[model samples]
Target: MTMRSILKSWVERYFSDEEALILLVVLVAGFAAIIWFGRMLAPFFTALVLAFLLQGVVSALTRRRVPHLLAVIMVFLAFVSVLLTLAFILMPLIWNQLVGLVQETPRMFASGQGWLDQLQERFPNIVTPDQMQSWIGVAGREISQLGQRALTLSLTSLGNVMSLIIYLVLVPILVFFMLKDREALVGFTLSLLPQKRTLLTRIWHEMDRQIANYIRGKSIEIVIVGTVAYITFAFFGLPYTALLAVLVGFSVLVPYIGAAVATIPVAAVAGFHFGISEQFVYVLVAYGVLQALDGNVLAPVLFSETNNIHPVSIIVAVLFFGGIWGFWGVFFAIPLATLLKALVYAWPRGLEGRQTSQVPPLKQD
Candidate 1:
């Protein structure tokens, strides 16, 4: 076949199906909207996600014949309670720990410098004075920059406080309404689409369960992992336990990348405070154990096979979405990738096969 004929055949083979054409258009439009208005629509999207996450519990309650309003109220109350706890209690603790870590910056640098100096004295040829001085200079510059950035961040946070307040107020309200009107909203959405939406229905059926399970499971994983990390760090008397624990907990969002990145701060704090002491070793061991359990045990139980995304696909999604939408992008990367995968595989082919199948076979006279 000619190139033009091949192109025509391919289009007819797929886009000729009205359902496939409509799905393709909807997907493209949705993807474009997210890319274009992501930051502007963050709170709405956040509320939508939270409602979906809480829907499972809401469903369970309804199944037991609990009033829908009561179920929504109960779930909303619980969500508000958790949000307030994090904001007023956990956040303050983490903030204090961060302040302490920032204050201890000089001591960490001095300890590191002293260690480097000792190495230079003990191995003059391997760690020459010039090399040590050059290394220290670079380190000093980096430390200075870090401090400046931290100071700038603190100043800007006051401004962000307004935005934070807006989110806190807006998201809950949006979530409550979304939860309360879910059925109406779903019906209205369906009304906007074609009635014969087999492919769309199939994809939604699959994605709905998977996405809910994923969001809820991830929330649980973060809490469990963060709590474990805090307890372990506190038991080992490591500095900045709250702050580091929060990082460790949220790190699970990006799978492999999060755990690896979180290790740096934990190890750095332990090393700077205790040098090569038994305490450092103990802290190290405890941290390793926590990560091991999270990956090998907690993850399997909580996530099950919900997120069967490939590791490579996950990393690429993280990098791509993260670049576009920052942290939220990274957080939702796996699910979005899975959604894309589902769309691609579930997309209907053209009517050629059906037409061929319906045609009568040649009669043998």
Candidate 2:
């Protein structure tokens, strides 16, 4: 076939299904909205996600014959209780540990410098005094800047207090309303689309089930990993146990990279505190066990068969979306990739075949 004929054939094959075209359009529009209004809509998006996380809880309550509104109210109350407890208790403890870490920076630097000096003595040619000094100078500068930035942020947090208050007030309200009006909201959304939406329904059903499973699984993973990490760190008498635990917990968001990156702080704290002592080794072993169990046991039990995305796709998604939206992007990367994969496979194909089967072929012109 000529280039024109081939192009025509390809288009016919892909574009024969109206459902395919509609789906593509919807995807494009949805992406455009996110790209254009991402920051402005951050709170709404956050609220939506929060509602989704709490939805299972509300559903469970309702399933036990609790009234829907009553269930929603109870779930909302529980959510607020957790939020308030974190803000009042957990956050302050973490903040104090953070402040303590910052205060100990000079000691860490001095300890690091001492190690460098010893290394230089052991390998004079490989570790010149000048080069060691230069590297230490750079590190010291960076650490100083980091400290300054952290201090500045903490000091200026008062200015951002209004924004935080707004988020604290608004997100819960939005979540509450969303939960209470879930069916009505869904119906209104569906009413905007075409009456015939077989493909759309299929995709939505699949996405809903998968996204729900992912959110639930991830939440459980975070809690379990964080709790385990905190217990291990405390058992080892590691400084900043609460703060490090929080980091380790969230680090699971990025899969392989998260676990690897989380090791740095854990190692740094361990090394500075215990050097190469048996306690340090024990700490490392405990952390390793936590990670192993999380990967080998917890993950399998919690997220079995939920994410069908390949490892390569997941990493790429994390990098691509993390670059765009940072932490939240990384957190949602796997689910978004799964959605993309589902879309690609679900996209109607063989349009040309369908048409050929339905209509008589025209004579060659």
Candidate 3:
């Protein structure tokens, strides 16, 4: 056969193969590269999340006959106002708690040591009082060293601070443009795609719906959890209820394990005042009940019919990202997973070969 005929035969054989293993490998590698790049640009990802969240508010205002520019300004101003109000209400309480904790640290340590001694006497096989004291001292020194290193690193990064300010300034500018011209921007992007992939437009809309629902529902859940936490703490006469509630609210931003982590410090502090057996139990019960309510009631009510990610997937994502990138990773894991799922569901094969559901069309503004 001629060289041209042989080449045609080879091309036909390659195209006829159903596996496409090499193509799959290339696609996976490209995806990994994108995820690595995204991880490196974590702050930008955060800004994008903030933008998506504010986009809805901007759209709502414009739907009420407000101009896009005015809506953007109003939403931004409202966000700033809420932050300022929260700061005004909670900062003093936090400062007072910090001051009190500082003054009482030594006494608290002494009390803890005494408790250790009692425990040691009750169970001689466990750690002795002297060993416990030595361990505490070592821990204190290590924590001090860590703090000093962190402070030094912060002071050395004056340039980072300036860059952060620039990024903050640019975020609102980007957000404003995105909110005002979102439809145009999306249309432009979709236009760049091949005509064969027109179905992807529906997928994109579905992804947007998932993200928006998740954000709105999570916000409502966080507020509910925070309110419940504050009320419960206040009812039990826990100190720094406002501060702890704030911590709880922020922790709820993370998916599975956050509530447990947030409960630890609060329970420890309360234990110092009310003794571990009594106060710790109360705090534990309160937190457990709150978590139950959140998981069983609030989550179902708010996030029903939304993204149905598995608990195992949530835990693995949290551990993987949290291990690699610390707190921000854990906090963003769900949204990132949701975005990936949406993209996967958009693929030609569809999500795990299941028929993809259509998202409701975007309503006119």
Candidate 4:
């Protein structure tokens, strides 16, 4: 027999079904171990994500004849400036509102109790006042307990806070190196793969392209939503317009659930302060219009050009990742899912009957 046939026969004979199952179990356990031990790597992963997102800006600067180091510095400075500007502009507004809310908590609590009393009165047969009070007491105690624990944790995590500061300081440094040596990194990573898996390298590059496009497209969509939200809120004379606009914009980064989550607080505040009739209706209508515009217009225009992911797939990805990693997972769900899709699209089963093409020569650094 030929060497290839002999090797295949030996593999088939030695690798039994039991061995395959054992290997599968081993892989699953290894993955679990990695995930369990991965928390310390979160900051690095976060930095990597940021670097990937800012790569376009770095590339643009480089294309403009800027030196790589200067390009990295400019991009980093621009990002920091924008963040600082937003903080300077919006922190005071949010802080003032938050302080007002805290000061008025007693009155709000009274109002809530009054509403509960009215509900008990209306449904005396179904829900007794005593039962309602018991429920409220339990809820209050739980909230208080949770708040205390959260406060304690925050106070105890000063070192964590310092670590975060260090991470932030290091991010730009890491990003600079990544941007400057991106091509070299790509080449090195690709070289690590066996020659037989060169196609996988090409697939990975395509996946990267998709990821970059998704990031750029989503950013543009966020800006559009934010601008529209700001305009609408300004027109409606909403309090904290800038802050609310920003909330809406940032929330858009989370997809469908994000819009609803953002709208809830705004709607509740408007309704509670201004009554549930006119102001509530106006805010609801405004958000409804914005959602419609986002779903039917902005998303299609932006995502259709690059990401053709199905809505159901997006939802599944959100559910899966959100369940696994909480908020951060949800934040990255779509990009991750898109990368997976690209990989699957390039898999052997996915590429059956596809024609081979001439491989391009690697560009010299």
Candidate 5:
């Protein structure tokens, strides 16, 4: 067969079914919208995700004989309460620690330079003088600029308050309506599809089930990990407890990469403060134990159904999606990858194959 015939054969195998064609179009359109209008749609998307997560709580409440409207109100109120607490209480705390961290950078750099000098003297070949000078220069420049950047941010923060206010007002309203009218919204969306949507339905159901579990499990994991991290850091008299804990908590989002990346600052803070003492060792050990428990115990317990994607695939998905969408992309990387996984496994080649599988064989005549 010719090259064109081979290409055509591949297309015929993958894209022959009408439902698959429609799904392809939909995926293309959705991706285009995210790339083109993602900023404009961000608030809506944020609210949609918030509503989706809170829907589980609302559902459980309703299942326990709570009225639907009341359940929504209760959950929304709780959500708003948590949001407000984070905005008012946690933000200020993190901001204060952040400023302190930036302000302390120079002192930390000086201490780090001392350590580098010792390391270079101890391991002359491995930690050469040239490398030491280059690293010291880089650290010095960064430390010098850190306070300037923080000051600039403080000066410009007022300009962002209005946009922040708009989001604060808009997101809750959107979340409320999305939760309250979820069924109506879903029905309207479903009405847009063609009558014969067996393939789409199957894919939606599978993704819906998995995504819910993922969101719930991740939320719980973050809370447990962050809380545990904060307590551990506090016990060790570690500075930036809230900031470090928050990082450690959200590190669960990207599997291996997040935890590894977060360790740098944690170790930096511990080492700078404790100066290679037993306290530093303890802090490191505590963090390692926290990570081990989360990986070995908590994650497995929370996410009962495995995503069945490989560790390599998960890391690749984190990089790819994180490059595209930044933080939210990283946050949703697993779900998006799982969606792709679902599409690959659930997609039908052609109606003939689908019918053959679903329909009973005709009686032999």
Candidate 6:
């Protein structure tokens, strides 16, 4: 019951076995490596993730009697085709729409300024005209600064173009080899671990299967939601449909935060296009419905296996991991959180079995 005794008990309860200590050291080392060299090895990590993502498809193909190398070729070619389509076709269109959106943004702000000015006059007690004008001035300044920053980035993109080209060339080659030699790679990795690794194996299997499902489900959700958004926007004749739809699609990456952030641009575009009209209301309604269905229905269907996480835990994971790894962190937040939960819940040193053995039998009397 003493503090020293309690401390000894706690350590024994968790780290009584060498395996537990080994697992702890491994986790710490992996995390340290990422923090130290994540950026330098980003392409390697990215390719690893892509290969893992596409491995399921490759396996399916091979299972159907397709040769392993041939299956790799088929999947790799399909992946390259999509990449080319996005880079050459979809990207240019989205870029143009994005440029147009940026160009029109000033006019949208002006219109919003006028509306707010009127609202100020009509509701003097709630909002004074001076306060409204100040707010608009602040917004206009922010818009101007944003445009300047974007212009600066475009001008500097030339310097980064070589790095981009390297990524384009290197990632695919890496992914192909990874797919072609997955078994060898996995074997090499496993050979590094000690023979008695049941806990490690359990954790790997749990993380691997769930992470794949989570990632694939998310990718499908993005495509489905984005396509639907594009259609809805186009049907209503909304401008920047591709750009907006893409934003809406990528928004699913960040859970609650992404959805809310995406709504701002969609609503702004809708308001600027329809100007306090019924069509504007309808567009907002449609967007809301889409988000509702995505959260309540489509996501459930695609990601049923990975939905054990709580909303609050998700947001915290997004914030925490996002701070550490930015976009990729946000993208993998749920999976990482799940991994952490698995680690915490896993019993080390046969502790669960030991606890069960220690339990007394229930009396029938």
Which parts of model 1 are misplaced by more than 4 Å? Answer: 120-132, 348-365
Candidate 1 vs candidate 3, TM-score winner: 1
Best by TM-score: 5
**Residue-level lDDT tens digits of model 2 in 163-188:** 88888899999999999999999999
Look at candidate 5 and tell me the lDDT of residue 98.
Answer: 88
Q: Global CA lDDT of candidate 5, please?
A: 0.90
> How many clashes does the backbone of model 5 have?
0
Alpha-carbon deviation at 315 in model 2, angstroms: 1.1
Worst 10 residues of 2 by lDDT: 347-356
- Candidate 3, residue 244: how far the Cα is off, in Å: 2.2
Question: Ten consecutive residues with minimal summed lDDT in candidate 6?
Answer: 347-356
Once all C-alphas are superposed, what RMSD does model 1 give against the true structure?
A: 2.6
| Structural RMSD, model 2 | 3.8
Q: What would the TM-score be for candidate 3 when compared with the true structure?
A: 0.72
> For candidate 5, lDDT tens digit of each residue in 1-365?
99999999888877877788888988999899988888889999899889999999999999999999999999999999999999899989998998888888778888888998998899898977998899899878876787788899988997999988888999999999999999999999989889888888888888899889998889999999999999999998999999999989999999998899999999999999999999999999999999999999999999888477889888999999899988888888888999999887777533556868988878998
Weakest 10 consecutive residues, lDDT, candidate 3?
14-23
Write candidate 6's Cα lDDT for 1-365 as tens digits: 89999999899888886777778889999888888899999999999989988999999998999999999999999999998888789988987887788788899998988888778778889987678778888999999998888788777977998898888899999999999989999999889888977677788888988899998999999999999999999999998999999999999999888989999999999999999999999999999999999999999999888739899999999999999999899999999999998887875535566567779989998
Model 5 alpha-carbon miss at residue 41, Å: 1.3
The reply for model 2, stretches above 4 Å from the true place, is 1-7, 123-131, 349-365
Better of 2 and 3 by lDDT: 2
TM-score result, candidate 5: 0.95
Per-candidate RMSD, Å? 2.6, 3.8, 8.1, 7.6, 1.7, 2.8
How good is model 6 by TM-score?
0.94
